[model samples]
Target: MRRNDHVILGQERSMSRCTRVWAKFFAFGALCAPLFPVPPAAAQTPAQGLTAAQMREDLAVLGQTWARKDRSFTPEGRERFELALRRTTTQVEGMHPHDFALEVARLAALSGNGHSAAHLPAMPSLPVRLWWFDDGLFVVSARADHAGLVGAKIERIGRASPEEALQRVSQFIPGNDAHRKVESTPFLTNPRALERAGISPGAETVALTVRDRSGTRRQVELHADAEPARGHTWEVLLPEAMDAPGRWVHVLDALQVRPAAFRSETDLEYEWLSSEPRVLYLRSNRIYSVDEVRLDLKLFEMTMKELVDSAPQAVIVDLRYNMGGNYLNTILFAQALPELVAAGGKVLVLTGPVTFSAALVTAAMLEMHGDERVLFMGEVMGDEPRFWAEGDLVQLPHSGIEVRYSDYFHDWGNPCREAACLWATRIFGPKRPISLAPDVRVPTTFADYARGADAVLTAALALALDADVGCAAQRVRGAQAARLATPAGRACVAR
Candidate 1:
């Protein structure tokens, strides 16, 4: 999209508590606190069961709210939802609250939009935290009592193989396959989720088959915590940041150095990687602006000015850990990049399963505006380019679980023209098609992670170093011409 001036009618809703907690857990790479603290008396009291009528009423409200507000809702999704509802209604009398919540979550996932979900209450989790690496699912962290399990590869959970468990758990997550993988980590740690997914019997303890670094295979029984652990949709912790001392022990705690990508905790940060080549590295951990966090417009402007002044031959924008915020904050930054590095330079965007929502939008914007110079490297993004977002949450009456719905549509696969753009004109202008696939795909492997190596960053840096820095003659043709037709385009060409 090319626009000189832009206006946004409204701000995106703040990250839901579930999302916020996930962001914190991943960003900090440690267990901080319980998601929702319960009073001592409340913790001691058992959960009151709900009647079939109350559960049905909650489901009805959830369906009605989604039908009314979610613009992305489709006939196929609605039909499937109704069918599931009918089947579940008949069985609610015998179902537990946790099982009912999973059913509701599965209903929300039917929309196929990442933002749509049923945010269930925190559930008890096994002491160990598992992460899916390129090789397989492995334990990255564990409560002090189960520290021996850390770094062991998971072969099976109860009777189900790791692959089968992942497939079963995928039903409760929304969005594309990539997003499902990103959001399934926390759910995999929950014993209730494991039981619902048919990976284990509903019990306080679950058996796991694991192989340690020594290559010895053994079955380990893990018990769930007494208190419910806070869970979020996205929870990938950086291996290097596992050093923070807490109730949990991380496998990589002995490592002394943190990789460049995990070095900063700020929402936005930039530094010069090489003075001779004039390579600049910018990492945006979050997309929103909050003055209290030093992630405001002023910081953004200053960063952009430095980028322009540096005249870097190559720039790397890392969004692997960004779960999203306000994409509008980076519109001007995206628009200015094509010309900024058009002359024999490159713009590299790093994305992964956690690069979602507004973070995905930022990468799309870079690809749309920077054209051929913009290279995407790393794993697939959390969501598809064309997806639904910008909505609010509705809490179910009896269960109190929050179900989120999407009210706006954003298409990066096709240009946004006239009515195709659902939001107000003030918020967006004519947008161009953006391809989200990586030019170079680099998956993070457990071997690299265990040793404190960043294969993705290494590959991107190598590509940047090998790239030719001369402007192509055909730069002003087709899409380039269309971009150059605008004032920003003319300015870019003049530079």
Candidate 2:
């Protein structure tokens, strides 16, 4: 399809939490937490019937089994976690299952590992789709008008707040990642609670008290809507508001090839909207090796070359759904911008927590190339420069689990310094002691994506056209006849 702008949700998981099986008690812990209060380590106890000794044995088994296969964790880290487990049992004796699971999830998060997280039960597809990030939870797709909820924190769903419901549901579902406890819970963390609060399948409407951007408290009655047949999560067709002044473009890089070493299901897939005269929007869905190098600069170069050939007044490069592949492609994409290189124009880039690896590299590269002509839209770029490796998935014995980490770190030492090697990072890059920042940060919401509320894209197009008009006037005002001869200017005139 020739979509001028496209939204691509590339499902690229370096590690699959779904396939791997973990401790049942951990699952119980994840699901049971809603039933009782999560006690502090010192005050906690195992289920009422299970002795402290049994809890210790169960924890030992889980830790020992997990440790046998977990190469990411240090021996010291494992030992510390084992000690934490032993200490936790002293508190687990009299606790409810839900309470115990919460503590376990807490312990897993404490492991300070990205791979460690709670797993929630499979949700019966609700009309809501949420994109979870460290900063906050975003409603990417929803059936509710949710206009009042565009940016409001869904503190409570029905009766229980998001946190309370998560604590309750996590008792049964055990997560695989150990880094963020909050990240592990699924969208249906508190279905029962949400139902009680009047957000159930049969409910025609939901009542919500929301806090607006102005910090004013108000109650909004939202009508239930149907999910869009196509696209991810919630989908809403947008209306043209030509006067609005914000633009955000998600430039997804769909170039690059799979390295010969680790070619999986997805390799060298390029599907995007290109060659539009008014605006050139390119999205890179994956990062693959262009040549021998890890960063494929040529693919981005080609994308820009295409845009320059088409000579669109504005271009939006969306890398929001791009999962790390070739790091250099982004840099190449920045260097290839027609405005910066040809028209002396500008590009607007859309980003978010979903922006990772080569995507981050691309964002960083734009800054380095003196491309002030570029603007960033969406939530903050993933602060982590994760070292990505396409290698063999090694399964550890006993645990029946597989783990993947990169063999090297890809760092672009410029405006945004990245890791030289792969270690423990906020996202996945080096331990740079600090994180990178975005030029202009915009939050992503369900309404924005649904309504095609691409503030960045709109802004980029406006700025591009505005700049183009001014530049065209300067260069070709009295020389209309001369401008007509130029193919690049001809399309703008035709439009």
Candidate 3:
């Protein structure tokens, strides 16, 4: 079913922080002009093929039924969503199921929100896992059957080169940044996505040209495998002594993180990643309570107390693995973060590609009020400002393809953001998200993974060296420590 990949919490050691992120991550793009690939006439099967009429009906229902019900699609995103559905319905008549699903994904992502997705019905992926990084796609993980190809750089998939394949896939990946392409492409490392994009000739297998880790070039006869359902994790690293080793994982990539069981996130956990410059690390793996842990609403106040009492050199809150259970988690934290900034601590919010939804809201809130002391360093976030979100799943009666529609319109404090006309980005080939302007963009590459780099944390500490936390401690609080007030915080409040 179509989904804006809200991942189940899972564990994997990647770029080292023993990360506990929740989502299926990593993907690239493809080059399907018009978004729909032209399926060959002879490729159609009465059993698996969808008719233009059926597609038209689905599109009609999208506007007349689902959109009407999802109401979040109205006022701004409604017309654009309907127009995309209309165009795809006309184009889908002669397409096969995979191709049709591809178009549906694009139409859903066109809503310009991560919470809304046009997902194809679930299918098993190929045995090997393909990764998208700053350079391009690579084989990061493989089942024993295809173990020989692990770490190979994928250059082509069947008929199309990697660049072409990624462009075609990009349109359907929800979110408006290059980071979304990387986070979403792993789900498409299958034969169907390739065939549907007109990049592969069939549904069962595809020819993958890859440059092996040793620099040898080869074509892998990759075949479909019943991919196991992925799992999630919620873990916490206890506070460490000032000179203790960091909890960051130096080995393993994203998929390699396999925590056997979940951990309790009922309380907030803080650690000291470094003592030389004194970086206090806080990991917020989940936003709400789960069966395994006690959900603590006062955790934010406790964290603030900890920050004030300990008086560390800098505060690093790790929200990369946080998959949003409560927006209130963000609200509470946002209300108090200015204290850290006011205390002259360098506050670095360490985020990853999967930092999403309520977690994004939290980050946005911190930035909105966290003053100059705050600096974000990592990949572009999973969601964006002015996007459709808070959704429910809907399935088509005929195709059974599931789609998630937005339930609410979130402003994220950006009045200039217009969700209806949002343009999603794909970092495939030359077209990248020009708007993904992180203060410091760190690359989580395979090479970086191999060297066991906690790139985000590393970037943070490195940035800390340049910051003068000492000078600010001299009590120049009122004059030099003023925050850059966002439009949301600038206006007068009514009693």
Candidate 4:
């Protein structure tokens, strides 16, 4: 999903610098060399605490780099960063060593670029794993010692409510929209960030208020995990693979969690939601991980062709699980989707908070293509067509904290969303990003989350099942007239 520095050697050579910042570069086209890959070269985190001088040095370098190269940087974001840096440095100068990295990290987040973030060094955390669902934040899982916390609705951590804590932690996260932060909150809600941000008084213990399934609300105290803490994974430290597995899916499918999207063993999966009229369901999790064994243009083409040939009553493509990959793959897939439309099968594209990056582009391409047969449903996109992406990592010297920043403007050929127009304002400028708003805003409320409900997909199929196939194009696209249909009736027509 990332463009390596070698991308500068190919079609990207038209520019004077590297194209993408996703450092986890893969071999695609001319980008043969992986630049800034961090797995092998991790510096040992220091055993001792950091001094104010070291923190200051890190901020200086980070600010300079971001101000110089961040594609989404703006005067407002810069002003906020400078103010936060000045105010926070003075506080960190005398604060505990535990708070140093978080303090500086929050300042980096002031840049407001989704590709840019202040990464925290690995540290001990509470045992429970939390995640945000449409209902609210809840404990998804926890160590054996804290197993009871699972399924409890998270009301507060430390002194702040789950919502309040998320707001504070979001200052250090570079997200284009609220959904981005909402989808990623659990991963970022560690003890280090909580303590440093003053949500928790000390790192040793945390206080929480949660509601059990019975709706009983009470306070609970849990000690942080022990020292020699497990190191952070590449997904946590970097921006590229933020599609780390989450439990909200299981929570949505309360009875038995079905394997679909990223949770599935395979990247591509298809099934029949119903028999009569035949509602087909398909999900492509990640652009790069499509085949499980090997994902390339050929595999994608085959999958699309197969899907179209099935000739179901309707087709539901679940992209909610897709965390992005090669954008070109979307174009390739689009080329083959007309067959499904021509076959009189309606198309419903499902999205959610996790739908991001290249995925957003794919959704935009389908929407902008003006296809009458296609429609989008679910949460608004996490990223946008007009966004700063292809980020490069800049690690701080003292703390080994990684700072990612966008270096390229991904313009989806939209005039109003061009880089120049986006950056030309004091309001709604680059710092204040934009994302695609879905046509049908479907929410997966917990009460309706049957093991196989697939709420969004279910909702789309409900709207589509009774509609005339010939009207699919005009219905969603707002065309003056419905698209033409074949002499053969919509049902019983061989695809």
Candidate 5:
């Protein structure tokens, strides 16, 4: 599904310098002299190869350090921080580092607060991002060469498969008792497990086994290569690349959304080529857009209206490379779908972890509208609580460590009777604190889809075509199919 616009959540909008804590988190690879494989040290080197205990201690200390600081919120900041905290703590305890980081991103997203983020280490190799759908992995985007795996199931990565790997890594990471998709990654995309398993970029040839649409199994060998360069092209930055597999994939994604003339509108020579009829598929290279000076919402609205108007069914919303922007805008844009708002054509939304904040809101709203008759394909990031915050930062004058505080709160549970009062006075809202709850949860993971795994997407496509309703059920990824097929594998194959 193509998104119509980008919206900033809460309208409480808000970037950045490095501190010692930032350095420690980033340079952890070099700081491991006596942490894990070794011991603690006094020489001032940071720790690496952290165990579960160590990671817990580190997070706790980080929190305590913030609390001890003598900082006060500017009423608004206090409300923002508290609301953010409430929103954050709801999911924080069990989140893996990446998931935790994403939550931090969401908090930061509330105020556009740059200081609030889960620190990450710089990693090479363009990562393969996954979207969870009904416990199945659906590839959202990745570097080129690995495009074939976009719709393939990640039954195996190297010698170990998905289940085995997730279990082993869970010990060191923190997350809810639910799924352990990419959203659950504690740091550096399961740095501990990947390192322990000895996964390396040099291992270009990876073995993959996935089930086909007919329930037959096939084995494929993928050559992991860096995405090729497409000059200094805007399309180059597109979620997929502009060349090779990406070029074709972009065209495919756009076609799925809607067939329109995609042309560039710059006086300067731009490589962004339009499909026919002005359906513009902006390439994903960086977050910066060619129209660098326009309000994101207007641009999105204008473009979407143009494409959708050309052909009602011709519109296909592609967020494959869309990381995230104004979360609120994401939802408002979906309003443009006339079919979705129609009496019975339920909205068909494709979401994943990459779809955060406003994007998540859009999905939720479409689902909520009921009129949109919206159902989602692909994998979802997970249900997140939405709350507004009045961001106020507490900076440790000495260490330059910054902590965020909320000055206000917003709750979805506020009764309509006091809509105005609740909007103005509620932070936790004295009721159910959960912000947004996913009606249907999809467990998208990175390895399976990032490598071009496609069973889930195919399933979604089938649903879209069939207009199947009430298909929502607990998601179990490969486990479900594997179990269902156990008897068939035993009897039919033998027969």
Candidate 6:
């Protein structure tokens, strides 16, 4: 969830240094705020319900702000926004604050920009934390009071099935289908969001139909927690760290071992994996620097230097949990990574649903510059290669809800063409169309996670250790052939 200011392109203006700093400060504060005992400012909305006039004022502000600040806003998008705004304006009179906020979000989602959305402060959330595993939606973690719900597969939310509820909530999530799916998992546990989506009635407690570990189906009523729902953090997905003292209970609390991928909490970490070929495992959780500027770049360079000195046969660059940060700081590393691989060695890049924005950019950069020796493994990236990004947050005066706007466009799929692309190319160099589909797709199943198994890492390790070129080449060729069989992959191949 780390964010950074993107380079301004063409006639597009940049925020003032003070404004950027404050934006980051506030965003970090909001992201890291604890989930209980809402702050005084955020608690104001519940005390005094937002009036229709206030909602109208906020809608106007949202429109004006996006018009002035969002460069990606086109004539077609403006027309859609106006229509949606007029329609929503008619229903605001008797709508609840949560519904109003979602309507505002719907307006932003119309832009089709993943970075754009209205963020409600201190929004009420259910006690249980949900995650979408390969099997289905399941409760991964929960408050101590609802600990029994952990590991239970969610069958239904209220009257709607889990998939139906997710589809309903996805309308308000900005981004491609992949990004929407990633964002919608958390909203499944938000009573206000579910109510706004019509997946659940506006009630004090919502009914959840779940199948427990023993395959027992039952309904459980969960009330909203006292604290507001916070933004998604990848750390919350780590099984080993799920149990927090006496407050929360994790599904894998009984497991004593932790996966190698979940061992590091740092932004950049690298170590040698004990294998036949001597694999170097590098995990980048975020593209951020804590104490020093360009620290990620420095660490990346140092890691590469070590790879050169030791001449490891294989390198794994893990970006599964890296949401994004400043791509400017890591683009050079991406550009240089391909050539650094040892002559007979292979480099496998690990990506997942959280590998997005700046992180996605970096991965694409690597793929575009890399040769056959470089490969990708893990799930599809969070967002599409071509998308809009790079804008600051705007807070509404009346409701204080923050709306993120996007002003810049990025197309990592193709070479520079437009003004924005040209401007970026001037700094980042020529780009090439990139197919983000992994050469080897590895999904994390609930069973793998329940036992602290790192399936993706294990696959990478096996591939790296296999000295037989026939097996490795066959696997890569088969994966590529399967990808070419799909419509999207065929298009990528044609490109």
lDDT of each: 0.67, 0.40, 0.53, 0.55, 0.34, 0.68
Q: Write the per-residue lDDT of candidate 2 for residues 1-495, one digit (tens) a residue.
A: 133222222332222232123222123322321110111112122234654455455456546654444444456766776777668867766654434444455455443433333321122233434444344444333333343344444555555555565554443322222212323233332333244323443334545454544567666554443322222211111211224333111111111321111112222322222223344455554555423322232343334334444555455666665545544234334555634333555566667654554566666566555345666765565434332222222322322222222233344442224343432222322223223455566554434343323444444444555544333332222121233346554454444
Candidate 5 yields a Cα-based lDDT of 0.34
Which candidate leads in lDDT?
Answer: 6
Q: TM-scores of the models, in the given order?
A: 0.80, 0.49, 0.67, 0.73, 0.42, 0.82
Error of 2 at 177 (Å): 15
Give Cα distance to truth, residue 26, candidate 2, Å: 45
Worst 10 residues of 6 by lDDT: 1-10
Give me the runs in candidate 1 sitting further than 4 Å from their true place. Answer: 1-47, 230-246, 290-299, 417-420, 424-432, 467-495
By TM-score, the best candidate is 6
Please give the clash total of every predicted structure, in order.
1, 66, 31, 6, 80, 1
- In angstroms, give how far residue 75 of model 1 lies from its true place: 1.2
lDDT: worst 10-residue window of model 2: 33-42
Question: What is the number of residue pairs that collide in model 1?
Answer: 1
Question: Which portions of model 2 miss their true places by more than 4 Å?
Answer: 1-80, 87-108, 111-128, 131-155, 158-278, 288-305, 308-314, 325-340, 370-373, 385-436, 445-450, 467-495
Residue-pair clash count for candidate 2: 66
Error of 4 at 148 (Å): 2.0
The Cα error of candidate 2 at residue 467, in Å, is 6.4
By summed lDDT, the worst window of 10 consecutive residues in model 5 runs over 34-43
Give per-residue CA lDDT, model 6, range 1-495, as digits (tens).
010111111122334454355445435323432211111133245225778888888888887775568666678988988888888877789777777777877888887777776665566788887777777888887887888888999999998998899889888887777778787866787788888788889745789999998999999999987675543635557644444444577777876545656554556666555323456677776666544334333444454346555666787888888878766556657766667766787889999887888778778777877757778899999888777766677888887777777666677777656775424544564355558788999998988787776777768866786634333333323232233255543332232
lDDT of 5 by residue, 1-495 (tens): 233222221131221122233333434323322110100011111223333444444434434554333132235754665566555554445444433333333333233322232223222222343333444543344445555545545565445565555555443332222323433332212333344444422233545465533455677654533432222111221343345444433313432221111122221111111122121222221122234322233324343444444542222233322333333222334445534232333344555544433344445444444332555555543223333333334432322223354333333333223432323224212243222343344443333333333334334433433422212111112112332145433332222
lDDT of 3 by residue, 1-495 (tens): 111111222221122221111111210111211111111111112237567778777667666666665644445666787777767766775677666666667777665666676655555567666556667776655654566776788887888777778777676776666445654454457577677667788778878888987899988786776543122211111111225332222114332321111122422455444434445556665665444322333343344344555556676666766656555434546656656543566778766666776676667666666656677777777666556555566776566666777655555544333444222211111121123236777766667554334556556655554533322221111111122132321221100
CA RMSD, predictions in order = 11.8, 14.6, 14.7, 10.6, 16.3, 11.1
**Which prediction has more favorable lDDT, 1 or 6?**
6
